[model samples]
Target chain A: MGHVIRTRTRASTVAAIVGAIVVLGLALLPLVAGRGLIQDMFFILTMLVLAQFWNLLAGYGGLVSIGQQAFVGLGAYAMFAGVILAGIDPVWAIPLGGLAAVIVAVPTAFFAFRLAGAYFAIATWVIAEVVRLSVAQWKTLGGGTGTSLPRTATRDIAGTGWIEAALDVRGAAARDILAYWLALGLALLAIGAIYGLLRSRRGLALASIRDNEEAARSVGVDAARLKWSVFLAAAFGTGIAGGLIFMQIARISPDAAFSVTEWTAFVIFIVVIGGIGTIEGPILGVLVFFALQKLLADFGAWYLIALGVIGIAVMLFAPRGLWGLISHRTGLELFPIRRRLITTKGNDHG
Target chain B: MSILSLAGVSKSYGSLKVTDDVTFDLPEGQALGIIGPNGAGKSTLFNLITGNVLPDAGRIAFDGRDVTRTPPMRRCLAGIGRSFQIPQPFDRLTVFENLLVAATHGRGQGEAAVVRDCADILERCELSARANDPAGGLSLLGRKRLELARAMATRPRLLLLDEIAGGLTEGECTALIRTIRDVHAQGVTIIWIEHVLHALNSVVERLLVLDFGRVIGIGEPGEIMASQEVREIYLGIEI
Candidate 1:
């Protein structure tokens, strides 16, 4: 007889199989969907990518940072520099954006790690402000006024021609589809990577740190090192998303690129309202957010007011968020990371 | 041979001294129980040895190496595992996950390499039924068992138990003592900080009495419990 350790559940297994089918459908959507629908899906996918990374940091890693815009802004700016200055294709420049975010994150983490709780959160915001201010001083990227990608770069971006010929769409529409596909790929990568990480040994260390830092340390979890790695990793993902976003928009400004409201606040809202720690939360959250935005787009300030009201209501009623409330009642885990022990009657020999 | 030694370790918070020049040596595989009143700095002493709180003075050596300034994680990796006076399970993580964290990180081994050992510990600690349950939802005894199981999962050479039996019922306490005794019988060194005198005496071969951050007595359990100074200070009985 032996005890067997299992991490996957029937529900999660079903969810995985279904998830692949859904992804296949989503990947094929642009073939028949209108430009408006494609653009909307792109928005939702990119936002989902951002929300997932934020969830990893605050939800799992116990790092609440409001300065994620630093990475977004730096990534967008780096893409701009690569395209306008280095003459690199906009597609090739996306990874450069991620690199820039990592470089900035090293120093940012050095200072922010010194603070805890609310102080840590505020320190991150202040660092973002500093990064924004510093980037505002770069005259070649049009200083505070900002600049757009060169027409040549956008028209000849990698993979757009094949997309155009294959789909029989115009260049602008092809670009939109290309960006949409990249966003889809990125969203998949972010969710897959985060899910895999949470199921690994490091994820256990992270959970322990989140639960009790002192006990986690006593158990030999190198909290500081793990946090540093998470921060840098999140920054890298966010930077690439930032670059992808700006490449799609073909424009960048310090204010727009570093907009806390756009990059950080909305992301936090998505994770908070969806569910903070669970991987499924952000996916659920981004969809709700998209629907709300579409329904309330005309109301202006009241739209924001509505979002605020909903966020507060969820926080009060379902502190774990909407998905948390659902999962609590149903006991359904779409991304089950917990391991189970089963006593099996068998020989000890392997 | 002594597995751990502290020499003149002192710690102060502002104007108040918590640990005053405490020094001791524990031979390998011995279970030494510490009995002290509230605010006696017994927990702080454990912290100093575990590297949670660095001493303002003196040195700590574990396994023949000076660990006076080593961080808590490093010391844990060096085979020093401890339980908090208050159970500190990863609230959202399952009880089994808690042990997995300790086993993987403390022993510097992969999860695949340690799962069977962790499961064995879970059964030994009588937590196999609640293995998949979230640690936060556990009862007092369950949490206590988790604290013990987590420490054991680390495969530690030196196990430090801090007030692990403080709030348990008599039957529960006995069961826990049996678990602790089993751990000791395996040749692991243990330094337990406990106020439950009878339970402490049943397991530990030696007893150390602490008062106002000072060690007032250290000897065989019978002699230390019977000493006038220990009775006056720890038992609060007038001489």
Candidate 2:
């Protein structure tokens, strides 16, 4: 037992160090890369965030919600409203978007909680469509045509006017670099937060509830409360990712803000390929997903088909997923939540 | 004091009655054994006691508090810990993780304490050697041990065992009986439903028999076994 604890502690320490190094590398990437690459990296970082949140929800919480796009669209609109109408800064808009997503999640959870199993999944998808339609119909925000943020030359060019007027051209690059760092920082925090949560008591309850709801309830776990909490957290995380996405693109429209196909597909692919239920799976899956996307960009529609096929194949052949399969074979866990007694002390302890 | 009492507890699904006007008192620290033939609604009685299914017409009192409409989790928190007839462990989690979840959530214990309690339960259940194995991969005996470990992790004053020794070998059943005796000595109340008459005979002093959702016999295990009603309904047939 003592040895198992020591091994787990060592593994966690190694994971922490690796995580710090990855964060540092991401923080420094914008400095080394050109503006285009930095922009692409920002997009990928947002996708990583989305994937991690979805992975936590469906993979660990067993929610399997298809309507997460409701929060995604809500986040985009919240950012747009915060920046354009409320006169909030772009950075502050990200959290405001998350808050708005939470607000929407409250009602969504109420209706969605009434369902179970496959019905719940389908209900969430319907809710997302309802939100999308409602948002598209709101004339004040652009309705069907969709709205655009004020992109004055001052805002359009990265760090152009005010910073340039204050110092030299280097100042503008510095500001853009700061924005990239901000996105990277948020992504890392999301991963770290999820990792910590999965190691906490609440995470264990969620896992128990996921694996066997009947048994969990029999043991005094409030399944509804845990499911709702995870649902809300997932919405909040996806909302933040949405805001980052719009920030990277510097625009928001109904169709673009509510693009479930892209966000859901990418996140589902990442979790399915990397491994569901492990904190490290989303990170690894995101990296592999982006690598494939970069390599197959020229394939256009085929690229998406390839992603779908891969996801289906992985689900069929490797239900444990890549990380799950590896962990099964090697018994090496980076995030060790349980202590296994390696050697029995025999009748003494008994 | 009676920790739990059921008064005229009746439950039905559509036209079929599963638990018919069943009444019993579980005094604090008492170990009660329930025996019945297949389809005697023994499992349904366990479910009703644990609040998995609401009693259609009855009153359930736990620790002198009414809990007829209470949810399953609430009943669990109020000191009811039950295992399924077939072992149901969290398939994706390791044995230790499964118990850790039960310890933390069932008793609402903090992380460190829950961990300690989970380790202790694993050791007591003789599952320490396979603690790291995924629950889905466990053998029948291992799975049964995990089911018991999970229930024990709840730190319940009342533990309900639903046919836990059903599929085990005679030797395994003896081992499990010994474990239950140890737990009983520690002052935990137990309600065991088992087809293995000898297993219950070894552990429990009192026995109750059910048939067609109604109590047919209740007395000391030896006397209940000798009763003509019980023998004809359950024990007369070959083992």
Candidate 3:
């Protein structure tokens, strides 16, 4: 029998069918749901996008960077600079944020790749702080105290008027729905792109490097190049998510843009709680994270303590994350990366 | 002409030199067995040749091209493959996937070529039954086989085997000897550092002895075994 490498399972096929339908259902939520619900989804979807990019960087790329907020804050700042200073439309400026992040990633990779382990993690945090401090000095975008987009710019964002008419909602509610949809699209794209990359040949090389870096070099895998590329890609995607997120909120500040606790720490928690390596893990992780934020966000300092407690519990018990626990019990993988050998009927003829 | 040549290669950590001015020649398709007492720098010699460790004073030429300064990956891509003294397979990957990485990256084989070559390798290494299992789950013999299989996947012109038969039982050692013999028959040059004398003798015609990071004897396997100085240094015989 001839071998055919297969990663897709019957369960995965079924999961994809159900998952597609579910995403479609989510897309139509703004039609029937209240503005508050739409706004909540915007938060959840953007966090999912941010979390997925972080997972791809740390989980698959073997680069555990704590400075992801550097990109988020930079992207948001770029979006603001594009709209307020350059007179570009806000919708058009969104992609400019992603581009700005990618441009910054080149220099960041050179410095970051020089250090490893805890030193590398700390180096990233330091760099992020530097970025925050630097951005705070930009007087054009409102210095240390921070600034918001112009009233006209926020009010005249592309598609808001069209969304208001189509959804039969007021202008404000329409903006919320439109931003919610953008978050949903970004979330799907992030997951799909990561899944695709992890299944490719480069993904195989990346896995080997993560498994054993020295051994990977012995087998001719260029560890440095692969790590650099994954880092830049994660930065690019994170920047876009950051831009989209801030655009929805219509405000920006150096501290708010580069908040490590809000962006990086929470993302790490989601991936760890849900399962860092698997794509399905982040979905499960983000859902759990969003639920906790909504339900207990106002319990004062106790809420932070509760989040810490739950994060530790999942990490200690599950280790692989919530999706890991689910996969272990049910043997189901919605986004499988392992290849299986199957025998084909035409093997003998060949 | 030698397929691999090492001249005056030396390395030291502080004052303790692991390899001191070591020099050797390996002709095409020749199988040379290296036997040394513990801490004799036999494995260090292998690392130097494979470019995992650079020599302080030496020239290494593979296929008549100098590769002393090349990095490990470039040396690997240039057709030098070696197994670790301890197996270092990617723990989370399946056995087939480990080989797939080597075949693609080390040998630069395309997708279809890698698949076909990997199947043949798995069968040759007697790992087809466990190809789908994680490398970490393999038995001792299985892990050793994987180490060899991955190195072989690179399609090396010069293969270095480090203590491959060290911990195997007699029966397993015999199987490994046969595998090594088959590999030699395929015209790939081999330099094996082994503690298992019987296993080394069966596959290699030439034997080189080392002591205190210096070569003590180099000749036919029987001649090296009969040398008086080799007996004193390696076997600790008074004669």
Overall lDDT per candidate, in order of appearance: 0.92, 0.81, 0.88
Worst 10 residues of 1 chain B by lDDT: B230-239
How accurate locally is residue A31 in candidate 3, as Cα lDDT from 0 to 100?
Answer: 80
Residue pair clashes in candidate 1:
none
Best by DockQ: 1
Rate residue A77 of model 3 by lDDT: 96
Candidate 1 wrong stretches, greater than 4 Å = A348-350, B235-239
- What does DockQ come to for candidate 2? 0.60
Worst 10 residues of 3 chain B by lDDT: B230-239
> How does candidate 3 score on lDDT?
0.88
List-wise, what DockQ does each model earn?
0.81, 0.60, 0.65
Q: Residue-wise lDDT of candidate 3 within A153-188, one digit each (tens)? A: 888689999988887998779888889999999999
Comparison by TM-score, 1 against 3, better one: 1
lDDT of 2 by residue, B21-106 (tens): 99888889988999888888999998888888888899999889999999999988888898898899999878888887788888
Cα lDDT of model 3 by residue, B173-227, tens digit: 8887888798889999999998888788888979988888998788899988887
TM-score of chain B of each: 0.97, 0.96, 0.97
* Clash count, one per candidate: 0, 0, 0
**TM-scores, in order shown?**
0.98, 0.93, 0.96
Superposed on the true chain A, the predicted chain A of model 3 yields a TM-score of 0.97
Winner on DockQ between 2 and 3 is 3
